[model samples]
Target chain A: MPLSTVLTLHATTDTTLPNTMGHLAHAAFLALLDAAAPEVAEAVHGKGENKPFAVSPLTVHREPCPVGREGDTRGASRTAGRGRSVHGSRFTVHDRAVALAAGQECRLRISFLDDALFRPFSEAILTLGQPTIRLGKAELLIARVTCVGSDEEPEARYETYEQLVNRLPCTVDRAPCTAYREPCDADAHSVHGSRSTVHEQLSFRFTSPTAFRVRMAGGERVNWPLPDPVRCVRSWVRRWNEFSGFPFEEDELCAKVEGGVGLARHDLRTRMLEFPRGRELGFVGEVDWHLTKHALADEPFLRQLHTLARFAFYCGTGIKTAMGMGTTVCRAP
Target chain B: MPLSTVLTLHATTDTTLPNTMGHLAHAAFLALLDAAAPEVAEAVHGKGENKPFAVSPLTVHREPCPVGREGDTRGASRTAGRGRSVHGSRFTVHDRAVALAAGQECRLRISFLDDALFRPFSEAILTLGQPTIRLGKAELLIARVTCVGSDEEPEARYETYEQLVNRLPCTVDRAPCTAYREPCDADAHSVHGSRSTVHEQLSFRFTSPTAFRVRMAGGERVNWPLPDPVRCVRSWVRRWNEFSGFPFEEDELCAKVEGGVGLARHDLRTRMLEFPRGRELGFVGEVDWHLTKHALADEPFLRQLHTLARFAFYCGTGIKTAMGMGTTVCRAP
Candidate 1:
């Protein structure tokens, strides 16, 4: 199994600017990456003297611009004149570049540091009798910089500017900005400004491609068979309950068996197993046995057997868990 | 000058008994010593023993038996029958002890624990009329312990009865029992009956007093003035505020400066002053000057000074503050 890494991006701007904002936005994005993951920063920048790490596949999303007011031409004019507009965007780059595994979905939402700036603009547009874009929804276009004659906006500016604000190449949709009290929606493209404006960008790299492995032969997979440990434990406990005449509902059985296995495994992993190097080897076996044996054992004898099995599993999975286990296999090969 | 130690007690009991419940109200008294000088525990019950230390001068007060009550008839008949009763005699010890402190104008108050046993009793008493016991204007019985006595007749005979209460001696008014919620108001005494009545008394040697010196001549001798580095630092801060032209009223200034110097000195003594043998020495010097020179003169100069002084004050007071100072103090003197 591989350790999965999640990357989240939050963009905010006080003033409106066109594609020019992408340069600064990109810098901020890179800074966030460095702050969040210094090891990834080292890999991106490089280890040599004076050579900074390099970041790649820096995905950017442009959320819909909120609708502006009709009467308040001043706000629109200001945005038009400044040539910089805020199209709040969110970009996420998984640690691994591989496509998401089947049945695995990553849910993300927009997070804004300062919503005050966007509030005035939102209010200005709402007050005016104009098609105000929903605050958070990625649909309204306050300003667009494009090639001299693009299909979307015929009177454009630069050649590649038209290609910059295009839809992201991945499955994307609008998400609510719950952090903000106002009803603002977010889109993927809003994160990175027009691509033509960004000169230097950050990217990601896998230190080892085969660090995680998902093996189906041995029933080792990430999120396979729904991976509902509670269900598995409940089913096992229900079988025992029926035989023993113990009155218990599915939820109760699930809770008791799952909680018991979890608590026992946690105790064994934390208290019983001691690694001098401070490595978390014991947890791997504990988790494996807890999921496969302890949680699913019905017979009293089997329950005892499962405890020992969980202990052995802890020892076996120790190394893999420490290295990071996921569906994606990232190895030197 | 000695450090003025304020004793406050809070008690809770099941409310059912008549006004007679106050005698068993002992938690507030014990809590007073626990709050004022936790180190007193070591003094009374040798080092490492977990027994309460301080002894209160006030004898536990018990009200006269109410007329028409089952227990009252027995108590009143005995008092009239024998010219004196054992229960009444037992309470005489508390009255005599409290009389000494009362004569000295010491602050006193009864802290009644709000327990189920005391609820009905309190309600009935308050409904009928407030019980008043005046020991001079200076030393008034505040009626602190209003709890529930056993439902069994108060005069019920027992081969040997245990007094399930803990007591501490103090010179301050008890805190209102209602102010503290249940559970917290119940002390070990209320939870477990008095240890002395049930078990063979075990004797333990008390620790020797750790002498602390006070340079009274050099500085103003405020109430309970002692060389507490913490209070010293706090006083220095107040002096600084005054010098800085902050408008601090008399009560406010006194409250601020009262224990500040002692607290600062205490912290400096335990934390900053260290010897090669690992023995720590208390800081010596003017409160304002020492803190200003050593701890406060760091980054953000003035702010740092205020922070250190505030921290010392907080540590000494054992209260939470922005300075982040409250910490346990342990020293080998």
Candidate 2:
């Protein structure tokens, strides 16, 4: 079964971690994979076109700097000359650190889409004895690593989905629901004679800064804000369906759900976010809108939509979800 | 002493509450006050120009509806007349409810600016027997109310200035800090002789949706987003200093800190929010920035800024802080 695990790390000393801690986590994952099951690691990092694992950006449990420290200047570009100043490229980390007092705990959550890799990766973490993360000049040890919670089934992994659907007639527990492993039974998809419309509310709480990449007229990819809910959901379900190895009627799902769904209401806010590399407008706010369709024939597709949206919780939404940009909490009404 | 207390309420049954539950809480507070201390209630409601206590907006532990629910048509609004359908005014509570599953809990935090009021409030809550809150049709009983934690000191109860100064340098205990009433005194701000600039970073996590009202050029007060670290800090201090009742050099504080401080960085996001009344823009985001001063003479003022900002934890920031819109978590770097 696919698994989602949260690792809580208590810093053993006062430490300064770089801004982009996601890169550090990626490195750690690679190293752990090399040690745990080298073949799996090689298959994932070396040969595979589609990776089965996803990592979220490290959420620092500390206060952020008022003026963000940009430009790389940490240990990444440091030379071995004692008492000498080392400079890095424009994209280098700026001379600022997210300070953690000794004993401060920071948390990171990771998900394994493929069951074959979950146990080995978890084992690697267990055997990695006192993993030390480097942050600028500080080397912080993971005083303790604890897996606080886990969810096995497709639905439970996305807590927000249940929260959403519960407000409507189709409650997560009461309604006809199925995980990726179990296909929807014909009985659950019982068709009624007359056509009827169904309306469901979807609220996305962008837990972190989020943006989408769009192709411009020149065919260059430019960072863009996510405007259409249908497209967002479609992309999310497509990615997970492939990795899940579950035979979802992808085309049918797209045509019925995507083509049928329309925005009923929305309240979204956007702003420009400055990063070390460049500037991109992102949203760190909440958006609530209704996903509505006029035909009862779309009911089964609606159920599928709910299931896939729940999956988005674990897989995350949009680009750089693994790098920690798109952390979303979806709710239904 | 200004004290901040958090009460965690665990639900015993699945409950459905109206969207605007703050009004329900308001009624409960009044009832509780009448039971605990009638004189305090009269003094607060009848005599005081500015109420000493502030109640937060209910942080519903559930999702919300998309299409605006107007007109109270829930079970609560049903008329006794067999054939009659009850209707409310424009923007009536639509025929929907915010539900809480059985065994799910919601938390509400109240703050008392007046130290004397604390005991009476606590006493009233203690005396309250089976506090049944009326939320439209649903009645939610406080299954269990536990005081999870509190911050009482020169801040919480306006005990003194030392608690504020000691905390900044001592820093929430070795890297991890707990917000409470304890005062920490340590060697952090050692005066460096020659003039030098000092920078401090501060961040606030809006535990609830928050917005501020600003007077436009037309002199009409309109809801506005919070701007400028200096103004934010200044307003925060001004409110608490009056509530604190501790005599301090207020003029010096403004000239030294507000005049000297400049914003080094910021990342803020805001969105339009829908309440029972109508639509208003609000922010549910994380803001980080630096307060910088060019001279050592401003160190004392910076210390004062830190102290007051910490006070904001209990007092909250901006308007309706007591009404639940301004709940914030503060941290320093």
Candidate 3:
């Protein structure tokens, strides 16, 4: 089973911290596990590639303020005396650190990719030795923990690999027209009166900075920060195969996605993140995927695409997902 | 000189016609010239390779209506009783045709690439034989023709090649910070306190479907419908070189663009249009560009980039500008 958890916290004191807090969150999470389950903590800490869990950059539960003298004061607004929930969490990424005021509300989302880590992670969250956690120099008190989803955000979700596979709708209902056209896009199919039964159009919104580190022919490492449909789908499927233990035959599937999956629409922008060693650039935005008639007509592939799209909710997408680089979710336009 | 002219039209009768009218517009344009300037029309019709002029899809001066029974009646609302100009003219692309009622207002934008065609094109517009023009099956009266631009839309404009070259600002203004960081993006530059003297950023909004037909390694042609920075910049430069009559040395600049110019952001979508030959798929949307520290530092390359960016407004970004497929405008975000 896969499990996503959101830990809400209140700032204990006013302090400025790095805008990106994924690495710090990762460290604090380990510290939390050390207090409850040392063995699991040690295993997780020592785990190298394909770790069974991922963490998100800390997001304040308040609206973002413009950069100025009172920027820090504005960032640390408390949940008390406020009726409106923050619309969006767009922290100003600046050379200076972000300031969190005392009593400010915030959240840290964590997900376990493997079933083995689910119970342990849940237990660690319950039995945190300290009531407060440190992210950089700022200390925060654990205010709430949610494994449930809300209308706005799916704070938490749990699903088994088999459940994901078995729950797919087998057939897509065709529209009024039954004729088909071969050499055109989705829009053309509608125009040519090619009433498609495959009506699923998934738009993955990469909310966080998403990037891929690809090893070239000569083993040179190159960063691909843009949304390429093949790469995006491959990353999702690869994670599905790894955690779900699926012996998925994906060669043809990947090739089809590469050739047929056109980028239907996008509103993407490049962003930069700071790491211990250096900095990296990635893209953040929504990319709508357009499937070809063949891909849509193939029942198995269609189901597979849907499954992968839903799985992306928990699996993330590309490199550094554990440190909040590939936070992905499917959105309907 | 390049001239972009907008002709506002009023429908004489209510009629539902094909959603896309590029081919129809082309036919009607030639037909109009048959009465006004037959020689120039014959030359344009005979001219192969690069066309000196382009025609836009007819845009109704009214808000788009939903795909319901009343959609046609909604599309044809005349401007007679209203003081407001229509917003975005997103005519609903339906299986049927668009409905335009009596006295409905619309516009047709035409542009000329060659300086020699400017006067003849202007003369043709001035000496129209008929007061009414047909688009598809609908006949519309040429209510007004303007070469003067307003705030919302540059309805018409004229600029010479030398003027375009002379218009580029010599240098970019640096922000408050001054240290340099070569390894990060624009955000990172601001973060590392790299006060870049090169601060100019231009965004192009592809208001019409844009695409590239590339000849592959084996002479196979493929339609590239995504916004690839290299291809986008190269297309602009190629058109500039041809029409501006500049023997511009672009090898180094192109190499730098390929390696350094990054797609910063975009809100793009794929669209299909019917042509006389058949149909084609293209992308319509905005694509923001980011130049690397090295590219920004090179004054010549920077100026060249700015020149090409502005030139895109007139030259259009991709193939089929002559048929409104690459109708583009630069917008400030």
Q: Pick the candidate with the highest TM-score.
A: 3
lDDT of 1: 0.23
Q: State how far residue A237 of model 2 sits from its true place (Å).
A: 47
| Whole-model lDDT, model 2 | 0.48
The residue-by-residue lDDT of candidate 1 on A1-333, one tens digit each, is 000112222222222223212123223333343544555544533522111111111223332223222122233333333321111232222221212211121111111111222233234434445221211212222232111333432211221211211312232222333211111223422433322111011111111111111232223221111112343334233323332233345575455443333110110011011122321111111111121222222333223222222111111111122222111110100
Can you give the lDDT of residue A65 in candidate 3? 27
Expressed as tens digits, the lDDT of each residue in A1-333 for candidate 3 is 667888877777777678567778888887777777789889888876467888765666454422212234464444222312112543322223566777666777888888667676667666766467888898887777777768655657777777666555566653332121112133412311222244435567777778776543323344567778778878888777778876466787787666555554455655667778776667776666656555566778776776777677787888777777788876421
Docking class of 3: incorrect
Give per-model TM-scores. Answer: 0.15, 0.41, 0.66
Candidate 3, B255-327: lDDT as tens digits: 7676656554455555666665866667676656555555556677776776677667777767877766777
Each candidate's DockQ:
0.00, 0.01, 0.12
Native-interface RMSD of candidate 2: 17.8
User: Which candidate wins on DockQ?
Assistant: 3
